[model samples]
Target: MGNEDAVRDSLLIRGGFATLLSFLLGSTMWSATHPDDGSAQLVFLSSLAFGLVAAYGLTRPTMMSLPKRATWMLILTVLWAVLAFQEPTAHYMIVALFALYLYRLPLWWGVAATAVVMLLGSGIGVVVMGSDVSVVVGPVMAGLVAIAVAVIVEEVFMVGEDRRELIDELIFTRSQLAESEREAGVVAERQRVAHEIHDTVAQGLSSIQMLLYAAERDIPDDSPARDRIEVARKVAAENLRDTRAIIAALQPRALQGGTLADALRRLATASHENVPGLSVEVTVGHRSDSGALALGTLEVSLPIMVKSVLLRIAQSAMANVRHHSGATTAQITVVADLSAGLVEMEVIDDGRGFDVPGALVGASGRAQGGHIGLMTMRQRAASIGGTVEFGSAPGRGTVVRTSAPLEGHRLESQHP
Candidate 1:
């Protein structure tokens, strides 16, 4: 792909230089064949050679030194202006220079330079050649026309830059979201295995132990049945212990030290630790019977993956704030409105927000920048039966809100 682009650009530059060269060469011929004045073709050829070399030097890659480019443009501008006076066909050469001047130089200087060249061409045509009034009006009209085209071209380049920025941000957001989803899947699988062990192997072992104990009590001490029943009870107890150990091993690593409640609390409070000037406050929506917040104070049957993804989404959103938005404050709020059958999570930032159209159009799927963060949040939430919303405008701040069903999407805890 890179090679193809290089070839295409090379072809374009070759074509443009060929066109400009032809115009200058044709103008030299036209003046040389002048019916009245005997023209100096040798001087025209010398100036043309110098101008072409200067054009090459000026159009080198941007990595080249600015002084080098300035020297080249200065040489070319002087040569092209001199050639315009000698050869009428060289007017086409000056037209091409107008584009380069606008592109290479600052706004005011480039315009002034191109306008001066055009005026010089017109003045030379009328005063030196003793020409008609058409020479005066033609160059002015052409100058206006060229400037209009240059303005449009500049705007197109600016829009391209904006799109490029959007694409870069999109790629970053997609990568983070994909990693989160993969982690969530692994945790969910572990929870499923733990669930199977608790509901099947552990329950069966308990029943066997109880039945063996009852049989041992019923049989006489001397009977063989009593001995077998006692041995069976011991075996069942040992098997139960082993099965419990296996179930513990199958639990997700993230939940081993603390419950999901602790992780959520940490996520909410730690958001603003790295970013200075930007303050964040965490607010909990659910409370226990003892009037304590349910987030970190009590164990809830929340999935470790759920807690993890929530934190990830929050972190990603905050990252966007720092990168894109120039906001000063951020707020994170979690509310498990059980009566409403939903656990809602919201991240609000007072930053430069984008226009989020309908239905949470997850990132545009282009690896580069445009609106990928919100798309990532929506996808992560939707995977686990949750809904994500985005709201923002140019100057107004951004709001990210997501909700998951309480019972509909709950994962069984390792302890439970």
Candidate 2:
């Protein structure tokens, strides 16, 4: 819009200058050559005044409406036509009016008007001034050339406007897609919350209520009613504990919107806060690495599902290191390759390692009641097109590596 306005203003100034020049040269010529023709002088002077006013009206721009400009252009056209008939030298004024007509009138109308003005001006020269063939052909050919140039320029402007409109529509479509994805995420989270409550807190509460009811019915002091009460109290306490744990599990508050690096840093900090005698350093691969993203470059963010899984897997791996691994030093590494569409996370600990098969069995309840930390981490990785692997030996330290492909999951790395 701004570019079109600039073009319009420039053409207006050119037209005004042309009309002024025509009027000056024509009126002076009329005064000297046709001194006694007062009527021609009057016609030329009146046309000049109207043409000047109409040309400058271009300066007060109003792109959205055409009525005001159309009125001025129509008046200018009639006056210029009359002035040209009186004095053929004033025909230069028609060139200025042609610009206004081309800009304001419809296609067929503008062409017809240009032809009418050209024929009228040439007719005046031939009939009144006894102009020869050169006068007749020159202006006619110039008029045709001018109309062609105007049409080409207008077509270019129309193409530019169409391209800009397409760009805006594409932007709007992307915004709509982003909004729909957000809403889908919300719906998925709601479903998760419903399932967690029904399976954990709700079921636990129902069991506790039943146990207390049985204790109340058999409340005989001599018939083991005290044992029943104690059992009921224990069940109630366990239920309460389970409920709190379920709430905390449902709320992975540390994990939120951020880059993969930010999520790792926060997870490392939280582990340091919650565990004693453990100092974990979080680091990322250099830009030169195979699957490592460059720091402080175009942001490559992980999906919410991927972010959540990565954070949880890191937390679980760290907890295992703190409790089972005797050594205190641990390192968490994050690497991503946007071009290759790959992401990998590793938690390495300088602690005593154990038999991997035994750990898996113990976690699956095959061995005496064991921690599910490792098993849970594996499940979390698998939830989002990911993998979990451990490297360990009796004397060596443990390294838990998790990897996922950013492309196969059809996830896009958003740039901020």
Candidate 3:
């Protein structure tokens, strides 16, 4: 049971026992005033005192072992059974005992104990009042009510357990999603820093080496400054190589071989292998300066940044396809436009689709971690002055298209 429900039940049980004690005390005092007989009054007082003590003992601790609880219950039952002969109101206490027995004891044992006490109480009633057909009515009715209450409480406990499980699962899922986002952010920052170093530091070192060579050409052969200039050039060259290595290390594994087309094909092959139910195909193409389209060509050249963004987008798209799309076949397409100085990639899957607007909105807000893949893809594309679009609907398959400028080529041209 939840905390509130448990507390409420505890209060109710304690209050009920208190009320029962009050009723019994008043009934004993009334019997004393009537003075049926000295011995009868003594029996009534003893029974009332025993009941008060038993209620206190049973309700003292919040929890009790089954054996100990059953022992106290047995003692109370026998006391009430004996009191059934003397006090006229003593029989009603059996109803309260029914509730306690069923709630506290295991089902079978509770049922057995309740049945035994009920029979003993009713038998004493018949012996004293004679078989009036109403002898069994009270105990039977109380038993049914106690059973109903126990069932209701059990159902409430079951619902509480289900709610707790769902809450735990949600917490664990959110934790995993947060971890994934952190890792992705770290990787993106590393890639960005690598690209920055390649463009600024590595390029500067190369320029310095070229300038030093030019200066060495003008100097005399015996000049010591020429040797120092050559040494400086070698150092710059070595640093440039080191910078290139760092950039390579930061680059995605798929693009490490320096071939976008090959990397895409490998991605397709890997996706197909990893997702046994899905088959993947890759198409690399280019549009020439003459506006002619050529498909299935691997000679397309793209900037490193463009390749990196496109590959990451493709990875995200394929992941969605493999994990979410429920697709049987998928296709990855890359096309470079020579005239426009842009490259575009498209991932299409013939699978179940979803609401694009809703997905985008959820992704933008990072709600429930449901659309994180789409959000990451958009961010990766935006990093390179690119745009990604999704075309999808329910049962109509999905297409993720992204286009980015060739920034690396533009930078080289400006530098040259």
Candidate 4:
């Protein structure tokens, strides 16, 4: 059950239980102590009447009518006290105090009612029953006791209400915290993706532009070098196509055919064929149906911020492959496991590798900024609820790996 309903149910149950217990205790006490007195009979009847009245008042649906109820209950309690004075009885005064406690009447009203009832009941006992021995002290003691019980019950109820309000506030705060964290994660991811795109794809396109511009000036129209320029021109055009794809992938597509696998294959083919001397090979592992669903769902369902980040990561990786990797051959791998809800992608190059620390934190002597590629890649992965890592040394080639949790998305048939 919801928290608010549970609290209300508990309050009602306890209130009913307390009322019942009080009634039974008072009836049993009066029966045992004053069995012979005719006044005891009247006291018993009055207690019964008060119990019924109090029960009705306590359980009624009048939370919004509390002020009206309190005023009426106060007036009734006063009238009952005056009647007890004319024909005094122990049960009459007890019932009045019980009413005060149950309704949470004002302290002045409660004190005054208890005092007046006790004084009148004691005076009648002294005059009619000739019970003077205890009359002086007994009524005063009962009044004090009634007031104390009412105060304690009031305090307990107030504390309970305060605690319940606190719990509700805490629940609201927790919900807000969860939402804030999710938004922050999305924002952080986007920053990383943007950085990657700037470093990788942007840089690659710039280099290609420079290469073609330099070639245009050196080669004659009829020369074989001119053919080389044409090849470079085609490579630049193909690279532009891949760049456009990266942009499209970043956009939100309700339903685009071809799984993540197909997209990666197309990327690898375009990269290898477009870059004249480069050979790009892509491999796909046996994927679970669930993993495919998760990846596809992510592609289709992710918030715009997350999608943008992933696209930026892809663009950055391709850019790095073109510019930094001197190797003629490169490899891209894509793997997914549905049951595990895992999706992984890796880009490996057999190119010259540098110190990881130096690349991230530029060397002391070098004037230019350090390698931002790894940083951007890592950020992008983390933003999409994933992680990225790079493995490399001075002589060894570099490997960039990224992994993320997959949410299910329906896969559509690939178009030719």
Residue-wise C-alpha lDDT for candidate 4, range 1-416, written one tens digit per residue: 33432443356654864565465547544553554655555555555665566566556533525486666566546544443543444333454454443445456666776677667656766774576667656766777777787678667767776676556545544564465456456554554574466358856775787788888888787887877787887887678667646644543232134444455566677777768788887666635554433223323233344434444555567667777767677877765555666666778888776677766553122212225456556655775688877778876887878777665322322110
Model 3 CA deviation exceeding 4 Å by range: 1-12, 28-35, 203-220, 234-416
TM-score of each: 0.67, 0.46, 0.53, 0.42
Worst 10 residues of 2 by lDDT: 407-416
Evaluated against the true structure, the overall lDDT of model 1 is 0.66
- Computed on alpha carbons, the lDDT of every model, listed in order, comes to 0.66, 0.66, 0.75, 0.58
Q: How does model 3 score by TM-score? A: 0.53
TM-score, candidate 1, is 0.67
lDDT of 2 by residue, 1-416 (tens): 45665666576555665566556555645653565655765764765676566646654655525666667666776776566666666666566656656755555567777888778767766886677986787568767876897788778987886676556544554564465456446534844684567457766676777777777677877767777677777777677667645543443355433455676777678777767677889887533334445654323445546656777678778877767787678899877665656678889988888788888776554332223566656766776678899899876999999987665332233211
In the order shown, the candidates' Cα RMSDs to the true structure are 5.8, 22.5, 9.7, 21.5
Best prediction by lDDT: 3
Tally clashes: model 3: 0
Off by more than 4 A, model 2: 1-47, 59-68, 211-416
RMSD of 3: 9.7
Model 3 lDDT-worst window of ten: 407-416
Model 2 residue 215 lDDT?
Answer: 70
* Per-candidate total of colliding backbone pairs: 10, 0, 0, 8
